[model samples]
Target: MLSSLIFLLGLPLALVAEPPTCTPLIPVTFDNATIPRLLGHWIYITGASKYGPHLAELKELKHAVFDLFPGSHEDELNVTEIMRMNETCVTRNTSKIQVFWHNSTLVHADDQVTSMAELIQSDKDLLILKHFNNNFPGLSLSARTPNVSKERLEEFKTHLHCLGFTEDEVFFTSEKDACPLPGEKTGEGSTEPQPE
Candidate 1:
């Protein structure tokens, strides 16, 4: 009789575990109309490998920009570009990212332009990207970004923690504001598209 009572109590306790929290969710999203300041220019990035979850550092960002699309109202649509670092899958590492921006209007630009960019989305706090088999489809690889406000960064870090990533697994550097490349210039009509 005592053992039966213990089992009943323990069963309730086992079934009442708290739901996990999303802590490490990076605040970076493609939906904000206000373009991010870090758009354009390359950024140095390091993060946990998506496949192995092992830490890896990627080469400099090839490009980062934010493009825009006008809405029927005054609102605009935002599409973020997350750079894929490897030409082919390597360790299924986290994608080497160069976050950029473009609008739905520019989706079918010349091959030269489209080849240089791709679209991504952030649902809730999960960062997702597009993938193609016969055609482009959703590739929602649960991800975390270091490029965000400290508060948001902590939140995302919590999410990462839930996903088994330690604090040392993720790192990033924004090169957009660093000293300009030789002869590089900013302001209107620059080659680099500003984040929207």
Candidate 2:
């Protein structure tokens, strides 16, 4: 019981991470060269939005994980997401088509361009996307996996602040409550199945 209490006490400290510092974010174009680096599992670290409704929705979301699989077509990608919201696990699959024009990332769902974003190049493991979309207007920082560095998280928050979002508007997600993919067994770690 003492160990468990100690673990709980440390959890909040772990989340605070390092202080925010400007991480020189360089916008990178979405292309074949950058595609491979992005094709993998990404854990939603945290996001800050000026949109009120977006924050309300994010408050219900405890955790979310996304798997980006290269689609059969060159311009498309198969996206698998599992998120735990309101104490329920929700899963979604979609084919997203991305097109870049002059450094802007245009994202399409169901064959329609729904939102556009800014893709800043980080290390192979870190992905920083600055979105000004109508639906979820925010700067979101995601990682290739759950073990994200505190420095990276702080850097992302700095960028979010630079984008005009306050610290209170940020939504932080936890990996301890990860949702499972369809057909995945309970008590199993995150997995990726082969494309059919």
Q: What TM-score would every model get versus the actual structure?
A: 0.31, 0.73
- For model 2, how does the per-residue alpha-carbon lDDT over 11-122 read when each residue is reduced to its tens digit? 9997797545565667886566877777888998887765565566578878888888888776667787778876677666764747565565747464323545677888
* lDDT per residue as tens, model 1, 1-196: 9999999989878778754575332333444543332233322232333332112322333322222333233332233343322221111111223334443211222212221223333433333223222332212233233254566445445545565655554444343433223245745433432222
Q: What is the TM-score of candidate 2?
A: 0.73
The global C-alpha lDDT for each of the candidates, from Candidate 1 onward, is 0.35, 0.72
Listed per candidate, the RMSD to the true structure in angstroms reads 11.4, 10.7
Position 71, candidate 1: lDDT: 29
Model 2: colliding residue pairs: none
Best TM-score among the predictions, by candidate number = 2
Model 1 residue 33 CA deviation (Å) reads: 11
lDDT of 2 at 186: 69
* Candidate 1 off by > 4 Å: 1-20, 23-46, 52-147, 174-196
